[model samples]
Target: MRAPEREYDSDPASHAHSQTRTLSSSPPPKTNGYVANGHGSPINGSSKHLKSPVARVELPGSTIYDDSYIDREEYIRLVIQSLRDIGYIESAATLEAESGYVMETSRVAEFRRCILDGTWSEAEGALGHLGVGEDDGLWEAKFLISQQKYLEYLEMGKITMALHVLRNELAPLHMDPELLHPLSSLIMCTDSADLRQKAGWDGAHGSSRRRLLVNLQSYIPSSLMIPPRRFVTLLDQARLHQISHCIYHNAPVTPQHFSLYADHTCDTDLFPRITTTILQVHTDEVWSLEWSHNGKFLASASKDKSVIVWSVGPNSNPDIYVHLHLQDHQFPVGCLAWSLDDTILLSSCEQLIKMWNTESGALIRTIEAHTEPVSALAWVPDGSGFISASQDRKINLWGSDGKQRDSWGITATRIIDLAVTPDYTRLVAIGESAKDPILPPPRSDATAASGANRNGNNNTATSSPRTLEYLMIVYDLTTKQPELSVSLGGQLTSVKISSDSQYALVNHAPDEIHLWDLFTGRLARKYTGQRQGRHIIRSCFGGVDGNFVVSGSEDGNVYVWHRDRAILLDVLTGHGSGSVNSVAWNPRNTQMFASCSDDCTIRLWEPSAGDRDGDSSTRLAHRTADDRSHEGEPNVKGKGRSRESWVEDDSASRSL
Candidate 1:
């Protein structure tokens, strides 16, 4: 016998109060002799009422309740519907009974059961009863159902019935001829295996029926069954749309953020892999390399007295090749720089700087301003001009027309390297500082006078030391005046400023690199473990937020270290017979980086495919542990905050 349908009160507040009253230890309140119903209606025609039950509703920590947006009953209905749509039938039934919500009607359950039982006539009637419209979706669903029934008849060796079903049912649906032709051919098969081979159906009763039901749900309106994965699919589309429009999205969107509705299965298998491309056109040592701002091309200068422009393909595959080669420089090219617009290329040879048109490889301008070998070159932020430092103890600013605009001389010491901030507000130059003359001891005035008279008339004499001290000077670009000067012990080979201009990466001779805080002029951290004595090994700041420092080594390997913690991360090797001269990371594509070496080849490095399967959190934890292991012994002495103390201590230790 059919059970009577249960009735529920629509008043959520009264229902909740009744549940809550059961949990509390309080006496019933009454005004008259009669009690009141849970809905605030007086019973027995009296104005008095007993207390209602109180409900203990435990909300999630992150939930904020708003009755105006959604009422208690509506929220519970949504939950129940979601549970049933995802195939959690048992849970949905339990929730429906407890919450007094009926999400799935008897007709919907009957339709599902008919499909699973292979009762084609009942399923069709059920679909029609569910209000499926006479649209293309309806016809397409009917065709699939007819085709499945035809296959079932053939599988049971009833050839005559299979032909009758196909010719009458499937043909009347007006499906495309391509689909109809395949269904008509299924009747010629003798056995289930033959039918499965001809028509790509598995001939499985349960799985095939389940798939047909899923397909039919797509045709039926969501008001009937709430199309499977409807909430999840809509949420995914919204997230992708937002990510595509976001201005600051650096990585792909993942299912780790807050969402109203989401599927918990997230594929976190995104990582780059290395290709097999190695540029071997240069016949001599490659001294320096730089990427275009747009990351379309790579310019490499070598000791072969040539600069080769490699065209970087969009796919970043193993097909990058040389685009242009400029061989105008008579001496070996030492440094390279691209203009802000990436149209002009600058290559520095000893005492000369040549400008070439990047597109045509034509020599546009040549400036011969330095008296000695030019050691460093930096373009102004606006690309209006450039600055060149040389061993002649001079620094000159030149325009694009090859004319010197300004020139300044240091205190008789060769300039080693220079770097300008991204904003062009400050310029830092590293060079040797002038030394004070050594005077004879004051204890021998007579001996000093006798020696002076023997040399000249009667003047005291002094001698100067052979070696000068190395120092770094910061200059105000607007005023062209020295701002701060600090002494350094070892010779500085290369200098790079962070993108934010907060710190400077300075490479010292032999093997050490120091990170200096620009605002305070204090040493922030130090990186080691690279052999840098023989060549000018250039290092750069990379990673998503410039969290890593990548540099070349004389040991024929590329070394990477954490910028803040100074922990060595990777030591990549493949440079055949010489030291790695420079490493350049793609400004746009952070996954790929290139390293050029004295072996006259450029090698590309990327993450292995195996790394993609590893969890991102695990990789980060490993990196942090490595940093801790390397943090025990400080490379720089004294945790000094003052500039003087830090520099002086570092200089003294290096001198020892």
Candidate 2:
């Protein structure tokens, strides 16, 4: 890598002469190395150099689609979708006409015309397409255009080119939507009904490639070029629609297209192994545990009410969630939180959310926000604010002040858990359903048929729509109304947002956990192996669609469930005589995961040798030092382990 130019920083006077690389000089990558003649193998055993990777501006407040670049309407749609993709809608005040609402109607109309006609050239020529004219706003243009380009790749026939722009062009457009990766991954995709008989993929190619070809809708610019290449674009049944939606991203690298076969060549397959250890580590009875926004600190709220903050170690344990008011909750703290900025620690007793300064351990503010017990709290990613769900049957939005901004009533019998998308657009709640299941009469024919004879043997499994079933509700923060609801029939316990906000997982009561597609509002996959009656604590995802889910169950076991074919990849044991209560992942690390249980223990796991069964093409791994700890190893017993995560404090100690 070339060193940064010292002159650029040291000599302010010479800044004018510094050669600037336009934003990201991220050229479309060739799966095969660049050759002297632009052919294969370089022919000669000579040296070649790729440019040092540049950072993508998609930074905070930079620009999405600036006036300097592309068409207006395309940019506008992208803005809407991007807004939705990022989770901003749920937590943000509606994009006021004030505060730089960049999309003008003229721009919206003209761009729509271009997309309909398949005219990137004409669109490029439009008066307001780029910012050179009177309406120039590069940042706004970037945001808007990138969003449109996303949809276009699928809508138009430019999937290959569209993805090139996203990976090679758009993502860095701004640090990338803080929450897009997660939302993108969470989109609903149904299994592909067709499979190539000859290739087992139905066409002789593969399921992944087929998915890329059909699921999404986007507008492709005729002018933008697809660098010649070939690579894999793997998609299974569960993600057929997802691949289609983001189809633009699946284009091959040309000639030797980048592989996406999910066979020894892809890097997203670690979830199975990682999930196993997480499950094993939570086998004991767990009381509770919490995750840092970056997924570092693992805090467990015990039945004992005392909270233990476990340093994910290695990384500095930023004093997170320390708050003064937290100490005042008279009841055992039922829930705790580390704010998005790593700013405040929030604790819930019955009806209050006490904000405390993690560093000073002083009470900051208290909101009499709920009428009943408060169960979950989430901070908006943009750092705009936060929302909390409570047993009071309400979700409240609170600004820095303890005052409530807005509140929405919930029907979940009680609000048990919550997850806010990174963009803050949607708040997902797992609670009772207005449409719960119906109960059968006491004596049923099914019970008699089950081979158990009773006086009138009746066992009813299917009931009414309003039963106390597990349901996921996508509540629009702006509208404050339930937009969509999905019923998953589990006694919903807890919910979590992936670091990227791609997929949200919920622990269903009685041994089944359901994974939901956040966007389309559908059940994407199902995870098995939860012990009946054990709490299915919570879950976290490493990558956007990184095949694994780590769930802590009440059976005192944390089971790692792999998606697509929802399998119990591994089982982790040890912790409390009770079930595992909570789990978290280091946002910066994919290989490392943490879990805490009622057993009063926190456990961490790493990949064995960090060498798993797959390809190594992309470089997203966070650097980690040696993290081998036999910490929870003895407890990974997976069954009847006496390990406990709860430790009772002496009354004398409490008084002191």
Candidate 3:
């Protein structure tokens, strides 16, 4: 049975009186599971004309189409409700009178009167008639009625009567001690005022009985009492079902935007595909990129040994310019992270982590704590400190001032990447463990024959192959203790947590991205089709509700997939030759995303504009080998190849 909706009786006295008057005109006669007729006349088993209520009633010249599947009675009830919803009381009453279908039965109307009129014994006896079976709901409803009666008895200064009801009536119901103890304690009140204050309920003359009636309605069946706003609920549910099935739905659904005439669906052109701007500030390969928390700026770490911060233009403008160029890193900048407030940015390279003031572009502090290259940085949700993972098998906590607050001991595996959940409850990390025995790399048959001949002539020592086992460990942020560990057998490059912190997207090498449900410690889905064997390609959760997965490929293209279906939606090609290394979706604008590449540029993408007559692919500037040879120049010095040359090379791949 469908559970009824929740709605309270607003004007209890008037509503009960109105229902009483309507049903009293022609009281329905009791029959054996048979529906009453238009004149409130019950049909017996011998009557062949009238069947059960579930059977369709034949109506002459009905407005509804005969071929339609809608039930005649249900349609009339919905019409009545729709009329009432728009404050048409007279119209609704007339429709009910003409349709000969009361919203509730005659028995239910009597029960409503008994509940509102403070007739406790009569109301309690009517519960079974209202279809409340002899179950927990029936007893629970009876307890509420008896409790209200006890409170009213005390309000009338009848202390002895309240005690008798508590001991004899409520105690025999076998309810929980927690509920019975409260009623027992209420007996100690000094007077009516004290009783009312302690019980937290008004007297019987107040709205207490009306509230009781509303609660008891849930115990009865919807056939006896219709749920409030049932028609509106059904329509809203149907609209949501349509939206859920739409693969490209990224925007919120509203009555102003959606129509009831057709099924809901969003156009694919709304996805971020067109490249509106190209940022060519970095002369070397851009390795990592991240948008600021407020989405006003974008930060990129590059192989040029520099970290550049770019300011995003306003919504009306479609341009990005270099905001700050920090050229202090000795090695290639590997990763970047932003504070929760977007005031601080951290860039990692080799064994050093640098904190910079985002607005002033001044270097705040530099800390060298890890022996190996710092692999990832994640800020604490509160902005008090940050956590950094390194390839040296260690995880360190540092304050915003670059002070080491705490450090976990060396782990068994080398930590590669880590992220702090948005809720600040858990910290997850991807570590590589080499506990298994090493096996040599497979050699070709001819190479093995040549090696054997060389070994027979002169014995030469060969190097053993390296082995690795990836493990994802989850730690309680408060206790800083490992809570759950899952073994994912793959070469993991990076990890990104969802906004709700319930799932994590882990980039797996050799062509797969695994979506893991963190709570279940299981891989929920695998997204494929992007080339990711050697280079460290990054992916992120995008779209308005994070229903899309956007990733970069070593094949110099950006891949977008539906997160729930694992369907490859688009392969965006813009970078000239080098691999697209990282992708970042704007936190503020759902229609925009950014992708950086080894082509030494950052491309900003937005939904396709209809007025733009060109193809979906963005035009890229042609570049000679000499033009890209320089490692650390802030800007390109020479004229690259023509736009036509790069367009012929970067072929756009649509949904597969």
Candidate 4:
């Protein structure tokens, strides 16, 4: 069998950095205290993770509620009636768990209302957590311990901590209506199997499985940011020729929403398609996408707990989404990484991480890996252990068995992103911290901020400090500890490291990209002026060729950039909304790029030899021979030529 290709390119130390300088003749950017923002600012602040501990509610013992203390059986009658009013019965059974799944004051009220309105069944694992009525003689007061732990995190802001909360310390216990309050353990169930399973046996998903606790739409308020208008405007101008580049040249949009160009000509197209076949995730915003080795399949984890594994082929259509429903994680699937031999997919959410069989999608193992939300996941290039960054302000390395091989955390705020080295020797993580106005620190000055730049959607708006500075973290996986830390001097959003793992690309508040060196922890190269394209949305570089990068913006245009020269390659205009979400390269071919956006389509692009612009080499030659020809004129970048088309899911709307 053929060995698999690593996600990382060959090491940068081994390769020559001077190679980038060669392909692009333009001068590298001048260093400045301020990172440039492309367009304007937005209102949403970067989410901060804060862990909140579970507040223990003291309950009275049996003696405190005795009839001798009460007036009569009347008090008992009243207590039973109140429970019934909240959908709790005089008999055993009926509790539902959610973000506020506990049988509490407000939750009970909500449960009562939901039951009356017929909206109660939608509650996750309600029937199991509520327990069943078996003969009404004996009751099992079991509780989905993980769900309660999640609630504790929600209350404590563990999700806010950016670290995942682990469920290992506490044993896996199924939900039972009787198991309402902690420290009040009761053998409430008469079921032989439920008791037997609880007494003896290892806890795993398939047999005695319980649902994972997850908090979707969970939010915390922070400061928003903006980019600059000049850059956005410049990118807007470059967008006009983008569709032409994609159609004829088949260039992918860099994160800057530009086509990869050296001087004025398009670079060798990279990131092409192995097949045109597409797979539908159970939901939108497929937060994570990874291709398994052998290139025969793709594993995608969604905000929907379901992980869909799709068979790869151009015209081959089999199971589009193999819905692997693991009762392990109840939260939206945030990050996924497969083991080297392609056995397990380590998926993380709020406080827990699980290992699943790639082929079956079943939860084979579970690990309560972090104290907060697991923000980022990275597989070691060597396929040994993997690294994860969490809101808990830490980075952790773990083995496939869910064991913590090593762990590290910063006193700094939340760790939002993580990147691992090729040999799995180093890891890079990025996160934001509050800018304490009084304490002066490392960055040159406040003017160093790139937050003023927006994506053209915002006219002119400045946001508040609920948003503060973000940090770029570097971890030495070999040392098993943090290597270096740098402040972006602004709130960071997304971070991308080069394939060579030498340079780190950062996207901050507003619209700006920082190309920083991994060794010195200093900004080396910076590119400004790519924003929401004419019709596209998001754009950035680090394409397949390891030369130039591409980006698709909300403006509905794709831009290719080589050093300072920003060029519009080709534009495919069919997205009704004039907005895009993400653009990516074909891992196999550098030439073909793909992008998906709010427009509900995935468009592919490549340069064509015969670009219908009528300014062909032959046309130019013919024009040069005639005195009346326009040979001396600069080839106008665009003449309305396009070869772009979209591959869409016909069943998307219908399936909905």
Candidate 5:
């Protein structure tokens, strides 16, 4: 797979050293006999100060930076801990002394020492002084200490002492009975070796005591006991924030690739703009698309009543091919859903939903529950069942065998699309209260025949004022009941929930995608830039952490926006004159994405050659050769474009 663009000075080791340059050269800023108030803002004359003696020397009157969020003493202590963690023992001690900010309180330090020495009673006694109140926190700490004490007694073959600790000490703590049952069984051990093996303990003399200390620290506040590797944790959080905010961050982050010398930002070229391959198995406009959970296969439903599952290559070659061509549906396929295991697929053709074995392309079963056209399909997270929404105003739950399990509910309007959250907590659907005036409504067989016989008097040919009342209904999947309903105004196309289940992106006509916060049940933001006043244009959540939103536009361009900021980042153009219908990003491969269009093709995309690794020349040459090899072949079912069209790079016109 292709990697993102990186700076020339990419030596992480050099960057690591550079990050510490300021730290190694400067001592903590000396306090001027002043300290921060309760709010951490500096006050005159030491109104408040840290418990550490080092705090008197090094902690500034204010935060580390003038506008810094962290308190001054806390920052110093974190630095001191960081210094100790990186083998700067003397430096850590010096900073602790100069800063007057002890990494831990004397009582907390003694608590750590007692735990490490296996002096269980002293450790247990020190818990109160370490600032853990007499509550569940205190009880939990005592339980941990007593548990360790009992385990050590067992390890030393002191069965009677172990029994006494377990019954009198651990039992009296009123802890979970489940926790004590296992310890009670340790009494039957033949010897210390048996006890250690069965308990999965390395013994009290090993790292057990130290591990206990770490566990006990959770009950103590940071002010009393510094969290281990506090400095490293802070840096990691900062780096993660940067990566999440970087609009073009597509590559996996690693120690070798991540650097603290500068904030992380990837080049726009890494956002999968360049079209690398064209899939032409479908004979008509590709209407729907979905990537299997594993990203190994991409399934596209087309207007020709066919579904094509394209097998994606492994990372090294990064190629794609036709894996299965299912032509069983007699009507145009509208939507698709892949089972969590990627072994089963559900494709909807009008009112009938067909389940197929993805591997063999055999129709498993056909579901005939929906009376109207099935608008969308979503599989339950466990893959044991699936959900089908229809214009019949009902959502039905079905088992893997295609038997209807239950109906969510009948809404008052037509359901356009629906999605179950990743956590399986809620089901969100886009419903329109009335037929949209701008778009033609679906007609039944009888209605179509009557309209055909009515000559020019058919009401279907008339246009009216737009009066679509778009709304989203959120259902509690567990109870199969509506939890929240949000009324929106638009010609709704589709809806996709974020991986976190916190936000839903609802595609709307007249060129907009409204992002709704599920928790607040409100519209959070609107993303626009692509033309989607008409036609069904589908958008998706993609990129790292699903931080980017991508959509197809009637203007024949793929629009990308940062999900959080509602900022348009890139407009990718490569499809022919037809409107881009839908887009899907490879869930497992962040560097690759696919866009299907009314042009009767699906285009695979990746980072530009300049920003990526591999033999691009050879890859492109192979693709050109592949396209040429299909020349002169019959264009099946009016697929429109010839195979030779794939070799021509029209990106120059499509790209900005």
Candidate 6:
């Protein structure tokens, strides 16, 4: 027998009493004339109380709410049109029926179907029915349709019919001679392959047919078909423009709320080109260069014992001119550093360190910093003091007041180079360990008889053998204790710490730059392909996120390598016949960087305006060559035209 359905009272008090009575196994509570059914429908009949208990169904916590901000009909219509445009035919049809909004008119649908199926007459009739008269756009659309029909006939081996369609349908339309001539010449094609090759068309099928339909849609009015998302497209373009102009814009703009979708565009031309403006004022080999934090001034030191600071103007007028020439150093300035405030410049020459006010070009202070030549200098993170390393086997910390605050010595070694971490937590030093002293051989008796020896012992001391053990040591600045000491093979020339202080780039002799993990003390990577013999070539890390390492090469080129993969990206030439001493990337600009060479010039590198203006063929060839060169092995020098030749070519073209 079927169980009687249970009903409940509509009043809350009566329902509570009924549940209480059922749970206590007492008689059921009497209900009013009206009772509530399972779906909350009122039933006007006697209640059929259940003899057994019933389980109550709990509703989900989430509730459905109506959106009143946007017009529901317009939004649904747009969604349906988008679905149809993207080929969700069944969903679009169902949505159109349910929403009672027609996304596409019958005439537009017929026109699209005819275009896709190569029914030229039907498609042309539909265009006429939609009021696409013999205007310029309609003519072009008709020409494309007629041309597709001709190609379809040719593919089916209907030569006579194909010729007929071309002469009767296509030739009548006043199209460009360049296009019409090509279509007319396809009549001589005997087979489908010949037509495909000669005409450069895939013969009116698949993507080609779909392309025709899209073209036809463009000529049709929005009232005949579905309108495009013009507002959304414009918003997307504005977002992209803002990002391209603002250097600090790192986050991508995505659709939110009312803006359902948008094409997020970014300027991907991040790498600088080879063509650059060469700053040619320095008289001798440029040794070191640095970009100030604000990117307004570039300070460069040269072997002529002079430092020239160049002021680069704003983008509206990007004129570069010499701002100051500091000639105080008696010897060649080998290194340069700018204070955190960009008001002071520190230059190193031999054992002397000079601090100069950048604006007045006055020497602020001079300190005989070391007993031996100072190899490296770095300012502390807070800019309160600085540190310098010397060949005297010592690392000295000095305050801004020109007083030595603390001094620490590395045992049995002369410091060759040093780099301090950005956080001021540690210091890395590279040097050669000192060897034990050796005594000279005893002098002969004849020399003693001739009284040639000044000493009575008649013996001289000889130099010990050259030390081959190169040491790389890390020290804790807070505790002033040795953290890591490892032996390396070749002589250390230069060292640099990453901005994040996570890795250190150390240049070892004969042509190698090692990337060492600071935390684990493991060799993370090695960048090669640069000539490095006796020259002190410096390597640094820079890029959008410090993903690339750039170094000066003795071969008169700058080599760039990817940090993660250690792959050589480019070997930029044109620094003349001398070694590129230093390469400094602008801290504020990714597209602009500077390279100083022994040729006595600093070249400012940026994206070439001509590159973006080149012809399509030229740009394609350039991009292809770049891609192939960076794929497998590093490109050898002399494989392409030298930068000198490229510059000369550019000059010749400009003359024309």
Shift of residue 385 alpha carbon in model 4, Å? 1.2
Count of clashes, each model: 9, 140, 2, 124, 8, 0
Model 3, residue 469: distance off in Å is 1.9
In the range 1-656, model 3's lDDT, one tens digit per residue, is: 11011112221222321211222232221211112211122223211222322211235443356777776556776666566565654455445444444355445556666776678899889887676987739999999999998898888888899889998999999999999998888878898788888888888877787677667767877655555567878989998788778888777677666898888888777777767667776777898899998888889888888888876743302223456778887777887999989989999877789998887778899989986667889999889999998766789999888899998778756676889999999998986776654423333343332222111111122254455677888888888888888887667778999999998999887789999998887889999999887667779999888999999988999999888888898999878887788899999888889998888888877765442323222221232232233222222122221111111011111110
Candidate 3, residue 235: Cα displacement in angstroms equals: 2.7
- Comparing 1 and 5 on lDDT, the stronger one: 5
Compared with the true structure, what per-residue lDDT tens digits does model 4 show for residues 186-282?
Answer: 1332343443454342223222221111111011000001112323444456664554343333344554435435322333332232222233334
Query: Any runs in candidate 1 off by more than 4 Å, and if so which?
Result: 1-275, 411-413, 434-465, 609-656
Error of 1 at 599 (Å): 1.2
Give TM per candidate.
0.51, 0.50, 0.68, 0.44, 0.68, 0.52
lDDT of 2 by residue, 1-656 (tens): 01122211221222222234233334211111112211112111101122233332222322345545543323333343344234443211122111112112223234344533435445545524323342443444444444444544533445567566567645665544763463233222222232122213332122322232111111222111111111111123324544333312222233353334532133333332332232222222334556666655555554444454444433221111121222354555666767767757777655667777655556788777565556678776666567788644678777755567777855544567788887777788876543424433332343232211100111123353233445678778688778887776556777876545657787776677777777666778878886645343666654334556777766777677655567666787655566666666666555656776665456555443234322111111221222212223233343211123222222111210
Give the Å shift of residue 329 in candidate 6: 0.9
Candidate 5 residue lDDT tens string, 12-37: 11221121111222233222211111
lDDT of each: 0.64, 0.47, 0.70, 0.42, 0.71, 0.64
Q: How far is candidate 6 from the true structure (C-alpha RMSD, Å)?
A: 31.0
Superpose all Cα atoms of candidate 2 onto the true structure and report the RMSD in Å to 1 decimal.
21.4
Task: For model 2, state the Cα shift of residue 650 in Å.
Answer: 16
Mark the regions of model 6 whose C-alpha exceeds 4 Å error after superposition. 1-269, 314-318, 410-412, 437-464, 610-656
Candidate 1 residues 100-218, lDDT tens each? 33443456556776777788998887777776878637777788788889888888888889889887898887778998887777777877899988887878454787778778887
Which candidate's lDDT is highest? 5
Off by over 4 Å in 5: 1-76, 83-101, 111-224, 314-318, 434-442, 446-468, 617-656
